[model samples]
Target chain A: MNKMAGSSMGEDTIGAIQEGIRNSAARMLESGEIDVFIGYEDGTLPLRTTPVFITCPEDAERLVWSPICENSLTCYLPKFQGTVGVVVKGCDVRTLVNLILENQVSRDKVKIVGVPCKGIIDRDRVGKALGTDRIIRSAKATRRSLMLEGDGFEVEMEIQDVLAPSCEVCRYPVPVLFDVLVGNESMARDGKDPEAGYLEVAQFAELEPDARFSFFAQEIERCIQCYACRQACPLCYCPECFVDRQSPKWISRWRGLSDKILFHLGRVLHVAGRCVDCGACRRACPVGIDLRLLTKNMEKAAKDLFDYESGLDIGGVPLLATYRREDPDDFIL
Target chain B: MLKMAKTDLDAFVDALVKASYVVLGPIQEGEATKFGVVGGEEIKIPRLTTRPLKELFFPQDESLLSFDRSGTPDASVDTSGVLASDGISPRVALGVRPCDARALVLLDNVFASDDYRDPYYTLRREKTVIITFACPLPGVACFCESTGGGPYDETGSDILFVEVAGSYLVKAVSEKGKGLLQEVFPPCILHEADDEDIQAAAEARARGELPANAGVPIEAAAAILGHVDAFGDSAWEEVYKKCLGCAVCTYLCPTCHCFDIGDEVTGASGERIRNWDSCMFPLFTLHASGHNPRPSRKERFRQRVMHKFNYFVENNDCMACVGCGRCVENCPVNLDIRQVLTTFARRELA
Candidate 1:
């Protein structure tokens, strides 16, 4: 099994890190360095995780770091007032950094405890790999394989086959910025080209315009106007989304082809340069729409034209917020 | 009751199609099972469809009426060709879960009420027939039994199918179902269900085919929830704390029938359309005067629960939620409604 496929780095490595997290959180809470410790706890559903808020030192044991901790806990920072200790993974760190840069969250109010992420396993992918709709009672992950126990029997499967598409291409395995680090820094995989992030977008760009539209339309058609994609994203903290506005209604929340198409385009455009490529929106989508295609195109455009990477530096001018004289405008009429 | 082999279902669907009945059933798309027009593909059996059958009756969006001004300076309003009315054809929704079928009945309380009758919903309800499959073992998140729904509960379905040892035992719950079955399946294909078949079906339900009981004090919770004063209770703060206010739960809910009507105008000639709306949205209760009652997520979330449990029961003498568990499965934060109900139940007891 490929080691980069979001499997547990080893029970020992994870156990030590979890212990470190609990101890650190408890100390912070006890010392009053932080009023609230935000972390993930085991979710009610199998292969899922839920964000937990710990205020008391004794509650720090509720915090756990694992491959299933999929939520970007930093999203909760803006909703809070006091100094909050947040457990963040690689993508969440970038999101937190971006949130700080955007002034959505105050850096002084947040104490970031970064967890070394191989990658977070996609729950849907695991279900697909298991090839069953039965509820998994429990799942145990080893270094190379994942054992899923359910109604009748347990099946051991290779982790690589079940890693999320985003995880397969993730560049940051270790958090670049952290107040406290948990676990040893993970090595980036050598077989995959981390720098070639826009390969999928480039490949899709090669398709004919009609084919591309059809590809996008078919995916958007499945959207049920849940808005979970927008709600789950750390960047989408707008008090009023355009779709929700009434005075100059941008788009209707309809399942019609036109409405679906317009909503997708409008959302992608809104988050063009601000999105951190966190994969939270795609993961949150219940119908499994390929949202990355749109977001990745925007990411590629930001990199190629503006020479910008979001959340890369502290307090830097955002791509869309500040205009550079060297900005590429060849496509402009 | 009549017995038919599972293999003969395709022929039943073909016969229904031949009779010009729009057959809507589970269509397997990638890893998800969604409800759509049957296309000779293998019908995904038992699994609760991602898209509820309610969409068949109350569509996501449809034009209500069109206005034309180009013909004459004064606009000529046309109400004759409302989009849904043009094709008010008979439909058979097969492979529906019992909870989903029950949800339609719950929705009827509002749409087909004596006080205000929705012609659009009424017409669809009259034209459609529901064929439900007895839900198999419930998943971890299911609590159908607590919400007046069960594996074999057949309150709203025209026909109910229970999986027996080797064949499906079908029971007609309504006159429409009886006529449809006789028309679709020949006597030679259907065997009179023996006592053994009925017994086995009972045994399946007795073995707890559905998930564990919810144990929520529905009666007490409903009573407490119905009070206007209970709206300010502190329980709402904890219950709605995790909610991201995305409307995923409400959109997927089979019984949620609230809609927003608007006009899609195009150069002075346009069509008035109705689209699904969720109470979870901040704008759902917003007024033109900039005043809002359920302004915050906490209030919005409480409104959802109260509407489902208290308001619906007060109006219709029945709970609105059918407990299909779609909300539980798809909630982005895993904010289980079952937990909320249980919490309220505990509060009521306290």
Candidate 2:
């Protein structure tokens, strides 16, 4: 039975998805279908969730499905041993797909439990609404509404206002591939020009060159150089990242504007064709710097120039690896 | 020693600015609060700063000394002339919390030991004055009580400020603090702090108690870590699984002081600089002979736990952590150190 009372969940169906995930995880574990199952569990803090590694069948009860499940669990795949089962949302599935393509993980050695995601809630927006008094005791979410209760106060907010920016404009809501689907498929996205895809990148490109440079410089200057963005990314699986290499030190630890710009731009270039735009890097960043713009532009370039969208098929060659006779080389001169 | 109206705080800071002290205060940068050069504006002290005041002293990157090895590998390296002078400058850091202050004292044991004292750290330590605000409301993640520090702990602070009745009861904690206070504010500017002020300060301190479930078991932590064989335990596997091996936790932690030194060379003119390092990174323990002692995340996480609880306690007679909770609050995957400690303690008891 669902424990949530007066939740006003209505036709949200997250409850059904939650139930489905727990059942599937338990059955799989008991049958020895997978060695470990990775999913999200309720966090101690309100409006937050933590990634949980389930090894035993009984521990599957701890698994949860909620709008607060923001992390892309696929990042854990490369490090996992033996046959593993993982939970993935629409965007997270892209990471799994890319991981398989990159030979980071074998397709047959893993099982994917894909979830039809509406969107994950942004904790910052919730904090902003609650303001300085973060004494939130409990919070419940429905498809369209979220209700938070605490000492002497309760706030009911439209879910749209609190949805993560990446989730809000998410084109993929249904997982592209899943061994077992947990929830009903989300409604198909409205028809749009697939070739002209990088809307955010196009908007960023519209800025004048100087304005663009200043924009990047101003944004990156706030970076404390923690490298959480790199650590959180699935594509950044290099044993020794360029920033960490001291011999030919590509970047310094200085907080200078040039160092900051180089780190962000350099990272985008390194993961040029492979980046899946899961927004994990931006979400993991404590300073909330918009690191998505540059990477999104790179993704756009890969798409427009090569007519490629990554992780669509595991057998397809990587964008940078393949060569075409008709490939545009106008800048070669 | 003195009672200052809350409104007069800004004026006091401005006076410090006029006195040629580079006054640093908690400044709001996006979602986080950082200690930055005061802009003659109101200081918005958040529940706690994301990065501790340790950065001001130990710094993420500092030039120890640069050498000129221009000609050949065997050429005489000139140590006399350094690229950046490690000069001491007087500065006042305001609005720091007690937990962060205590962590600095713990750091002093490492950087300013009797055997070898770091000049760069010592110079900054001598020149700067730290004024801390008694924490009124410690967050859920904070565990200062367990780490042998409290909300109003004055272990490392020069002055402690307690807000009472829209005014501050400022107590000079050390000789340096008292002298600075006297030089900045005349006798006429301050009134005697009475019984009410002390009572109010106690109440403020009480409000910052460590949340019950999240309390650090200092004795249990030390006991579990005390046994060398405990390093081979299986509990670390669970603790490290959720960790992304990110530097965020160590970088944000108040007590983690591991650093890596390297040279930035450009056509023979280069400076050797020290930058923050984290045990969570695999490369932190990598050897030149392509052999890493602690190659996996499990060993790395275990090293972090042992270093804070066991190693630091053995070396300095104090736990390295002051429980500022920046790590707990900022870990992307939400790997709480409190949980790890509680699990270890419970397992040891069992």
Candidate 3:
């Protein structure tokens, strides 16, 4: 019943999942462990998804879940008070964990109904991969299989063939912590696939010294400082950001590579160790900057140096909070 | 001690396969010296990183999983099964300035919470070591003392290196720093600091002040917080008028750590993710039902001040700030955070 690679389940499966969510929410609402049930509902745009919070049992009927539910809806947790029930896929649960960590929400304040994640496809990528204007009508995935149907091409692409950048290196095929779990658990990566996007990091390292600077320059040069990536991130929980200072302009308003690189560098630093590898920044970018590269570098650094990852555990302290006398400082004068 | 009389910083870097640590300091990428891991061997010191060093742990964009859209989900594919030994490794931050070191302490309150800890940051914290450089002179954006910090405070460093004439006077503040430097440098004698050295550092700070910022009025952030309700006007609107609903400020802040979660899957297997988020965005305070309590710039603007000055101080006993001035220096539209904070102190609160 899981949506895995190459499985040809249709929109019918999507409907069933939505109905199951709605029915469960309505029952939870009646029981009153939650005052509001936050989940995803279908959008007017084909395959687009929007956040929905159902208060009344009647409103719960509007709840719908689909493949297009791209946003990690934990955006509302801090602003949301009182007891709330949230429908969380494995990735979204990290938002729940983050809120708990920040003390923004009480562990008892929200009830999380967890869903296992197989892997999600990038709608834009699907359109690009198909090399057509036709939108992907629907998608079905199961273990080792993925079936996608677009405007005219009825090709069943391997899920690995078109996996999103963030998914290629996903280490947590499961939630580190959760209140509830849905369906069966995913089997461990049956011995990693070489196509799992490792080449991107290698590609970054493979470039000559000067070429890498150009590569970063190209990415930073495109940033408009819109901060859509920051806003979309679940880790950037600061009530105030630092770029708006006037006494000293840290980054220039002028759209130059220097300012853009400063902006990205500043951004990545604020989140270097905490980045969870969510593709929201890439998806939220209207300019199509591969911010993923910056975070990926940080991710590699975090793993190689600190041996840590975001959202994998519930009780771990952040990397910089505790210092080890013997922690590496080989470059210091 | 391993002497480096001729082998200065440049030669020291040349000794490594590729300086084992990611040397992040001020780089003139564009118009700013934003902090980034050195690509090869580059000497970027004293220059501000356009942003603060806060992002070293907090991050603006991050992923909890790789939404594979391809795997089969069984009970084992859930997030609860994730182990802590999977990712992240130890690293040494190369050019951390003193103010940046203090900023890390400001962030530690939330990061090291006993109720719930941020595992992502904790990993970095335990493994990464900081070697703080002394500020030769205060920048136009600096106001460290006003925020109960200084340009030379060792509140968050493993080692501190003061640039004294021809040599760097290094001191170890924490045990980690001391142990690491045992073999790197001669034992630094702890003594009553000379008044001449202190005076010289102060003189450098005075000389670097800009005319417009020659004498910025200053007061305790707590006294400023007391007037949160007093700054209750359109000053927020006028100041934030140019804001593009972007999260630039929060992304660069040394202490801001708000975030949101996401979930993705393919077949049955999926992973949850948490990425950085901010209150500047309308969606930050938006309820799932479509109602946003912080509906406008005024409320949002005021909220930022209250949290940094009042709420943080009241709760954590420290103004969740370190006066590194990254926010004041990085705004695209030139919306300065310090000016706003000071203005709120002068006009609104006064």
Candidate 4:
């Protein structure tokens, strides 16, 4: 979405969406409509983006809007006492809409300042992009190209080449619901283009049943019992968890094969109809594991049987909890 | 005096709708009564609903915010939301069981806290007035009077309607009830309830489906919950061995309000999402640093009881549990909650 203005339609502020963000943050705070503004600030890594809670409009000057940012800060919205302002993209707007649908927070209480992102710098992909020698010092992108300035080196790469794998299948690249939108650019990558999941699902059948079981067994054996998957998910909220169910011990957090399978399997079930296919669990893993395959299998099963997809619509009921009288009786017999 | 016959349920519904209010009544959906958006004659009315009306105000699942791919969140306005933000529209909830009506009042100790104000709940609550029906017959799981409820406990209702022979014996309790009675006064009959009838009604309550034998004193039950750690005295392993961690029991329970929020991003933008969660899940209490406080279903099961009985009463003077029995009836393994509580109370198992 870098294609900025050059003509009468393109004001100087339209060069990068960052300028507009600065203006909006200044106005929102000046108007007293919001107490704090959540925006993007620099991370410890020069090229990475971290979500920043900007209470001062001057701090808005320190904020930078770019593709390197990835956070769903809707969880923080409920904890705010007074008026709060937030930044959102397409997927983030879906979460906001869901919250609104549930009546957890009023739309009037907060200000939504939106930005359309082109692609974010994938840390894993970038490590492979420049090989092991290059240390990324700083990076910025125009509408078309991302320039990475590293230690004793400079490199230019196509935005698509550095985007995260999940972004490759991203459908909504523009803001779905926003109050004030920045960067009037949009892309409808609804996967009319070549998608990855169909190929993976097709290839899974080619593997024999024994091979599949062995493959899962081998992969699960390496599980270190870390719950990076749970932490990354926006939906795994409980005051306490069951992996540690002391009363009956449904699943243990130990590194045993049974424990690992139980942990992952039980987790997938809890998110059965509720999971929105965000790929956060797969991305958050310290170990590179294809955790998406299990979730995607559940997704395929839900679609094939119940004709359901999570987070597709704001008003649609969550599939797992709600039941129709006509629901299949597969488990009944 | 005009007598509104039982077959005139159409007129009964029409009469409520013409009263210029969004009419809500008991609806028999699946095995629950939480669904309360019926205003026409197609509505089903039973002697009592399995669940309470609290779900109407504090729904099972509601959204706090929506996030986009860009990591920005936009809060929802209304998709023709069931109720308006302001208190108007004159809502009348008909056929609410007295137990469910009292459950609404019980829920208030938590919702009406001085600290956090749930605006959505408060809005619907103020605009709506309850019209409860006396439980002509309780179900297999009811013990309302044993726990300070009766065949007709009345607190949150505006109008209390008793189903008699040909017409309804309507008792106006609140000013809103008085106003509603005036609106429907044209077809009303002034039949004063006598002492013998009230006494006969009280006696008839015993023969009804209510189990006064549920075996927990309402007053001391909350006190017994103070010893959350007292589970050490029982065999908890036998209690939860077959538990599959499916979380269906917690999801179906009327008062289980735990939820989780997440984000789904497509490129530069993504949406943060919130969905219902259960302590039955292994990751519900998992920490980012790889440590979990309650790392097994057994401990999670223990927490469920402590939170409902001990922690809830410790904080809000009332138990979070309404004894809806959804957990008991819907368990995949047929694990009854009566057995669980009985085991905790050290009662003789059948």
The most accurate candidate by DockQ is 2
The alpha-carbon deviation from the true structure for residue A94 of candidate 3, after best TM-score superposition, in angstroms, is 46
Candidate 4 structure quality by residue, lDDT tens digits, A73-110: 55456545788788776656655655555555577887
Q: Comparing 3 and 4 by lDDT, which wins?
A: 3
Question: What are the C-alpha RMSDs, in order, of all predicted structures?
Answer: 3.4, 3.2, 23.3, 28.6
Off by over 4 Å in 1: A1-11, A142-144, A187-192, B29-31, B70-75, B83-87, B209-211, B227-229, B348-350
Task: For all candidates, state DockQ relative to the true structure.
Answer: 0.44, 0.48, 0.05, 0.01
lDDT of 4 by residue, B1-350 (tens): 12234556556667767766777776644223444667665765665554446656765434433333343365333323324433457787887877667767766766667876666567778788888776675543444555456666676788876665544556788898788767764553344566655555456544543554345454454454455446563566556643445565566555666666554334654334344567876668987777888876678887787777778777777676665444543343334555566556653223
User: What is the CAPRI rating of model 2's predicted complex?
Assistant: acceptable
lDDT of 1 at B72: 91
Assess every candidate by TM-score.
0.94, 0.92, 0.48, 0.46
lDDT of 1: 0.79
Per-residue alpha-carbon lDDT of candidate 1 for residues B1-350, written as tens digits (9 for 90 to 100)? 89888888888788789889999898866455677889476666746877777888788887778998886989888876784564488989899988899988888888888898877888888888899898766766667887877878898899999887768899999999998988777776688999999898889878855347555466667877876667778888778876788878888889998899998888979888898889988889999999998888889999899988988888789988877889988888888787787677667422
Models sorted by DockQ, best on top: 2, 1, 3, 4
- C-alpha DockQ for predicted model 1: 0.44
Candidate 1's displacement at residue A274, Å, is: 2.6
User: Each candidate: what lDDT?
Assistant: 0.79, 0.80, 0.61, 0.61
**Candidate 3 residue runs with Cα over 4 Å from true position:** A1-217, A220-225, A228-333, B1-7, B11-32, B65-87, B183-221, B231-238, B347-350
- Candidate achieving the largest lDDT: 2
Residue A317 local lDDT, model 3: 67
Comparing 2 and 4 on TM-score, the stronger one: 2
Local distance difference test, candidate 2: 0.80
